[model samples]
Target: MARAHFAYFHPFEIRFSEVDMHGHVFNGRYLDFFDTAVTGFLVARGCDEILSVDGAGNGVDMADAAAPVYFVRRAGVEFLAPVRFRQRVEVAVGIARMGRSSLSFALEVHGEGEDAPRACGEIVWVAVDRATGRSAALPASLRDKLAPALLPQDAAPASGGA
Candidate 1:
C-alpha cells in the first residue's frame, strides 16, 4: 500500500533484546510492535486505551467500569522479510473494519527508508465488560473518533443505527 493511504505511522528502533538466536527479530516481536503502534494510535486520539477509559490519561479501574476493555479475539502476522538488530522500522496502522462490538486493524512494517513493507498483519479486537468479561457494544464516542481512519466500505458495518 502507498504511504499516503495510512493515517498513522510510528518509527521504532529494533532493540537488541528483540533479536533472536537466528540473528533476526523474533517472530513474536512483531506482535509487540503492532501493540505499541496501536497504543500510540489510541493515545493520539485522546484515549488511554481502546474499549475503556475516557482518554484522561488516568488509569481507570476496568473491573468496575460499565464496559471494561478490548480483548484480542484473533491476530495474525505475515513476515515478508527479516529484520536485524540496530535496524529501525516504521509501522503504519489503519482501521480495516469496525463492528458493533469489535474492530479490525491492518498493520504494516517497513524498514526505515524502504518503500515496501517488510511485514504485515491484522488484529481483531472485541470489547468486553469489565465485570463479566462478556462482549459489549462499542460506545458512540469511540466510533466517532475512529471514523476518520475508516474507509468507505469499512465504515458501513459500523453504523450505530438499528
Candidate 2:
C-alpha cells in the first residue's frame, strides 16, 4: 500500500474483456494482465528504451542492428487473490537478484481491498544476443536504467497481531 524504496510502482486499469463467464477475471487471462503490467513495470524503470523496436511499431531491432532481447526464463509465480471486473490495481516490482546475464524480479499486485495482495510472483530474465542466440552481458544503458533494481531493501515489518 505504501511506496517501497526498492520497488518500482506501476498502475494498471482492469479491462472489461479481462472478465470471463464467471464474471471475474479468467484464470488464463491473468497472465496477459501480468505481462502487460510487467512491460509497463519495465518501462517505468526506463526498460522500454531497450525493447529494440523498429522505426515502425514492431521488434525489428533497429537499435542493435537486428539484435533482439528476449525473456529467456521464468522463476515462479505465486497467485495471491482474484481480481474482479474493473478493479484498479497497482503493481509493485523489485529485483530479487541480478546475475551476469540475468535479473530476477519479485512482483506484487495490490487491489482495492482492505488488506493483502491480489497477486505476486518472481521472474528471471536472461540477456541474449539476437545474432548468436546465446546469453550475453546486459548492455550498459539498460543496466544503468535498471539501477534501481540493484538496491537491497528490507521487508515490511509485521503489523499488530494477537
Candidate 3:
C-alpha cells in the first residue's frame, strides 16, 4: 500500500534492549510498537482523554464501575524483513473499520528511507463495559473523534459485524 494512504505516523528508534539473541528485534516487541503507535495516534487525534485517568494522569480507578475501556480482541502481524537495533522506523496507523462495538486498525512498520514496509498488521479493539465485562457499543463522541483516521472506502477491510 502507498504511504499516502496513512494519515498518522509514529516514529521510534529500535532500542538494543528490544533485540533478541538473533540480532534482530524480538518478534514479541512488534506488539509493543503497535500499541505505542496506536496510543500516539489517539493522542494526535485529540483523544488523549480516553487514555488518561480522569484526564489528569492520576491513573484509572479500577473500582469505578462506569469507566470506559477497550479490550484487544485480536492482533496479527506479518514480518517481511528483520529490523536491527538502532534502526529508525515509523508505524503508519489507520482505522480500517468502525463496527458497532469495535475498531479495527491497519498498521505498517516502515524503515527509514525504505519504500516498502518491514511489517504489516491489524489489531481489533472492542469497547467494553467495565462493570459487565462485555462488549459495548462505541460512544458516538469517540467514534466521531476517530472517524478522520478511517482508511478510504476502497482500501478498507471487507465489511462485517464486529
Q: Pick the candidate with the highest lDDT.
A: 3
| TM-score for each predicted model, relative to the true structure | 0.83, 0.74, 0.86
Rank candidates by TM-score, best first: 3, 1, 2
Q: Note the residue pairs that clash in candidate 1.
A: none
Residues 67-149, model 3: lDDT tens digits: 46888999988888899999999999999899999999888888987767888888999988977888888878889999988
Cα lDDT of model 1 by residue, 92-119, tens digit:
8878889989988778888888867788
lDDT of 3: 0.83
Poorly placed runs, candidate 3 (over 4 Å): 54-67, 156-162
Clashes of 3: 0
> Candidate 2: which stretches are off by over 4 Å?
1-7, 53-60, 66-68, 113-115, 151-162
Ten-residue stretch with the least lDDT total in model 3: 153-162
TM accuracy, model 2: 0.74
Model 1, 35: alpha-carbon shift in Å?
0.7
lDDT of each: 0.78, 0.64, 0.83
Candidate 2 to native Cα RMSD, angstroms: 4.7
| Maximum-TM-score candidate | 3
